[model samples]
Target: MKKPLLMIVGAIAVLAAAAFLYPNAPSGNAAPPGKDAKHGEKGHDEGHGAEGVVEMTDAKVAAAGIEIVTAAPATLHDSIILNGILQPNQEALVQVTPRFPGVVREIKKRIGDSVEKGELLAKIESNQSLSVYEMRAPFSGTVIDRQISLGEYASEQKPAFVVADISTVWVDLSVYRRDLPRVRLGDAILIDVGDGGDPIKAELSYVSPVGSADTQSALVRAVVANDGMRLRTGLFVSARLILSAKQVPVAVKGSALQTVENRNVVFVRSGEKFEARDVEIGSRDSENIEIVFGVMDGDKYAARNSFVVKAELGKGEASHDH
Candidate 1:
């Protein structure tokens, strides 16, 4: 009887100790020993919850009328950019010089003065070949340069007045030798005057046969009409040369194209994910650009604001590494 009683008392003490140490312990979700209680399973559950919150915020922004465009097949016109200088047409520039040596009796027109054809520019008293010589304007235009004043000596070798017709001006543009084969006479061109206005239209009048030895560039001359006398000679202008007329596939905006690793690329939307794809580019217009390859027609692409997508992709990659 004494042994039985001792065994019962020891059993009761062990049970009481266990209950004090592990009060409120989980029954079915007990963790194994020597293992982390919160590992992949716990992390995945929290990560998915955070992702759900971010998705909801993004959906709200899209519903606010923010414009988004997808890639589509469209026509694009090709163009080439070239540096140009404005100059007076040969037929419009006139130099006033005396036939013989003489003393200038009077100077009529000053610089920046407008004159007409056959208008008198100055009067000179002949000293070498004749007497009382009168200098007249060669054409109707503005006096761009006047080097002689009253009582100044004039000669046949020196110009007294330089006049220019601003109705039509010539723009000398430089084109790369590699592109010279595509450029030809009579091609339409556009000149940006840099005056915050509409560009002037012109046509290619001449193409140089030889390229510059140093720059390896060929000279191309275009004639632009200055109907309103808005364009002035000696003003720096930018020229755009039309290269081809064939219609090729292009994007709606040029900003859609991005440069990656020294190559052109664009982000393509592939079923809730964006993939960066290298592309072959050909031509570009004022607003759109031609896409050569690495994309298919009707493919969904980030037309504008693609930097956001890139940032998200980078974050995901970083998280995976961490």
Candidate 2:
């Protein structure tokens, strides 16, 4: 009887120690973290973690003309800029050559002289025909180069003069391999003729599949009308390759975007507070930029006067620096 009583006392002591170490949980449940203290609400939970949030008074927002726009689906236009040089039209540039081995007996046109179609250019004494015949201009153009002199012997293989029609020209552009996927025939391109004038409009006529041996770039050719002879051969020019419009799910006005701390950000309105939210950007045009990620639809963001948010953020940084 004494041994059984000692064993029961030891069991009671162990139970008392276990209950002291691990107590039972409370009967009622606890509320989750970050919930509203009064009503346990979640309406203000979204976008709470964004940093650089600036709160403005109603008067200040109105005085600054801060307009808020909602992010929505829109169309985006993309473009690529290119560089090129103007060249003489290859189809119109021709070498005036003799049909037979001959000696030039008479010459009419000189370098820089203009000639009309079927106009007499020179007279040659043909060696094969044993007779003198007249050589006339093949087309109405200017004599750009001259190799034959008066009474000079010329052969069928040698050209006497080079003629070219300068009213039209070709713009040969360099399309890199990275840009080749977007470039196509029939695409419209604007050529900056570099004369303090408006850009010339032209259609992309050709693209060589093979890359150039010297530049390792594919050649894109466009034909441009050279009225008043403004576009000359060998003149360097810039090209803007216009792309088609594409609709996207999210886009914003370019005026709303600002760079903050090395990150592209847009100020989103949460109640009276404007939070600068980091964003990822995609294709863009002059007016609108496509947002690839960050910020959701129906989220109001500062459009015009977004610089005011940037200024406020700057003030906060300045204060922290002090």
Candidate 3:
């Protein structure tokens, strides 16, 4: 009986030693590291182990429409925006009038008709001699207004036709009293005519010496080439007057900027990885921004569609939380 009791005691001691040697050991079903079925053996998600980083392949980037641009020296404009309207270049507009009081006998052109230089517009019968004369276009232009019709008495007091060469249009911008001193002739201007088109580039051609007392604004003029006649007369437009421009050593497209965790960040590219780096910004224009810190010259960054990378980083954080 004593020997059997000692044997039971030794068996209990052996079991206790085994438990002590393998303390906190995984269960029989538990798989080793890099062999987990749910995580595909890896502890972290693919391309997402580091914080504030997103990984995307070249094909993925192109498919996402992410435009990558290199940081470089760029000219940033100190600009002021103003509202304006497009007008026909008055210098190129001409008013056609009968030289003498006459009767209109023939009408050859109408409003919106394209005419050439010396193009016959109408025939007028003189009242003084009962003789006929011809009205011709003074230059190549579109007939914007027609004041006379056939079989009507015409006079020299009123214009017979109004023609305008609209190949180049005028942008009349309103300069407020506070901004008048900053505006000057020959300063660069960009006219946004809308319709999702690019802004038309021009130079300040004129600044009115007179200011309207009612509006308290001066009229500033810029002549822009009206290619395709997109800058039609009477259409309101917005303009950016470049008051000053400065070159910075490091700059990136404005589209690359994003706010992350209450801080401004620019996503910099490193092979397949995009790291959100906190950046200090300086002067900024409509297109580009100056990076005072956290980015260097020649650094490649995601320009267009950079928000996609930010979303990806957010996903990583959410998954980590779970």
- Sorted by TM-score (best first), the order is 3, 1, 2
Q: Give the range where candidate 2 is weakest over 10 consecutive residues by summed lDDT.
A: 42-51
What lDDT tens digits, residue by residue, belong to model 2 across residues 1-322?
A: 9999999999999988977886763334655554455547545434233348888876788899987899998877677888999888989988989988789999999988889999999989999887998888899998878899998899878889888898889899998888898898999887888889998889999999799778768999998888998987877999888878788889988999999879999998888888888999987887788898887878889999999989987876665444
TM-score of each: 0.64, 0.55, 0.79
What C-alpha lDDT values do all the predictions have?
0.74, 0.85, 0.92
- Which run of 10 residues does model 3 get worst, by summed lDDT? 40-49
> Per-residue lDDT for 53-144 in model 1, tens only?
11223353355332246666665657888887888887888888887788988888999999988888888888865578788988798898
Which parts of model 3 are misplaced by more than 4 Å?
Answer: 1-47, 195-198, 225-231
lDDT of 1: 0.74
For model 3, how does the per-residue alpha-carbon lDDT over 171-215 read when each residue is reduced to its tens digit? 999999999988889999888888899888899999999999999
TM-score of candidate 2 on Cα atoms, chains taken together: 0.55
- Against the true structure, candidate 2 has what lDDT? 0.85
Number of backbone collisions per candidate: 1, 0, 1
Q: Is candidate 1 or candidate 3 better by lDDT?
A: 3
Give candidate 1 misplaced runs (Cα > 4 Å): 1-74, 128-131, 245-250, 257-322
